[model samples]
Target: MITLATSVFGIVLCKGEIIKTSVHGPTGKISYKDEGFGGMPVVFVHSFGGNVSHWDGIKDSLVQNRRVVRIELRGHGDSEFPKDGDYRISSMAKDLATVVNLLGLQRFVLVGHSMGGSVALQYAGENPSRVAGLVLVDSNGDPKKNPEEIRTQIKNVLFSDAYVETTETYWKQLLERSKPEVQERLFEELVRAPKDMVIKITSELLDYDPTLSLKRYVGPKLAIVTPENDDKFSLHRLQLGFPHKVIQNAGHWLQLDQPEAFREILETFLQRY
Candidate 1:
């Protein structure tokens, strides 16, 4: 297990070198780290407003026995935001393809958390043979309820003159349960993100409908969700013919709230598939 320290960000990237790779289609660069040597490669895609660091909690353990790849999508982390500002899930999925191709990956397990789950679902649906299985952590393929209030608030913050303040307030609410360091990291990244680009990507995701696409991926899948935060988009609601595991007493950031538990669950699920 390698530990890469970055002077630029003051963050310890575990398992491998922090590599920057260009992902075509979107015409932007993505930051990723690779670790491990054998077994089926396990690739991780983080959520919206997130980066490769999101997997810091479980990545070390995951990489012990299998090749692991974690990507920092465009507009987040060290990745370059697209000049054209194309951050759609489909676009991100294509970017993932670029990563896999660049790394010469064959069949592998795809794991995604939150918005990343949508990208994983889309990718798996389009490239079924390339994906050995899938794991969706605290994710929703198609939200049953439209979060109009959340949308309006985000739009207001993006367009309002008090953009920075309002955005900070909004982010604070989301990261309330995060560790202090994690919260700080997220705030810093969000502040540095191209707001207009982020808004465009988030707006598109809010309207995204992956209902049919998620169901069509006829491959092994494991859904892990926190019971407390599942009301909006519960694992029980996903009829993708997969086992759904519930982690109780946890919030939206399940991995942060219960890292060891989350890691164990994921490792066990991976072993099963």
Candidate 2:
């Protein structure tokens, strides 16, 4: 049976009786959805400018067997924005820590997509013992990979008066091959996000160094990426030998683009390590 309800606190019960709840983190209220029960819990973090719904396609299948917790970073979705405007990745990871601690998730797998993957990396690296496994989906772990020139170019456009227009264009390019409905949903969410917050987070993401975090978390790790990002110097290629797989013909959002293949790889990883 499935029922949906929203409480005064803004919590919602979605399909499959998933409990959508909120927790007060260091910055503000962080919203998350808790569903299923059993096995090591898998916590999902969405990409920048994205919300909990980004995991809609994959969560249903996993929730049938293991607990699935999808988190909305501060300033995204139903989560309250930080009044102080601290949008750094470290602060974002702290928000994630607050949610997991509230749920009493002692040990579980951490799955992050895009910028969310970076947050998962930061959290897992800091709390190595708490994370049983780490999965980064199309996430970049090395800041150096993003050259200064490229960063400057991106920042110029993001900080310029044409920020919103540029952002929309950028998103459109990424979602070019995606289905019309998928593109529309994501674009709407992106448009609704605060422009300043988006710019700040993107700036922080560009400067984030995942080297120490990657080294700290020695647990089993898997890097699922698309063909365009299967570079020899990528974190998966360099650190997670033989545990990386590139989903063919998929874009940045491979989970949505090639869910079956992505799920198979993830399930295989969970079964093996």
Residue pairs clashing in model 1 are: none
- What C-alpha lDDT do the candidate models reach, one value each? 0.75, 0.84
- Which residue ranges in model 2 land beyond 4 Å of their true spot? 1-18, 239-242
Local accuracy of candidate 1 as per-residue lDDT tens digits, 1-273 = 444343332233444443333344356666777777778889999987788777888888876778889887777767777777788888888878878887889899999988888888889988988998898887764543657787677666677788778777867776776777767876786677677876787677767777666666878888888664456355436553567788765555678768888888888877854
Using TM-score as the measure, which candidate wins?
A: 2
Residue 186 shift from truth in candidate 1, angstroms: 2.5
Clash number for candidate 2: 0
Candidate 1: where is the Cα deviation over 4 Å?
1-25, 147-157, 239-241
Best by lDDT: 2
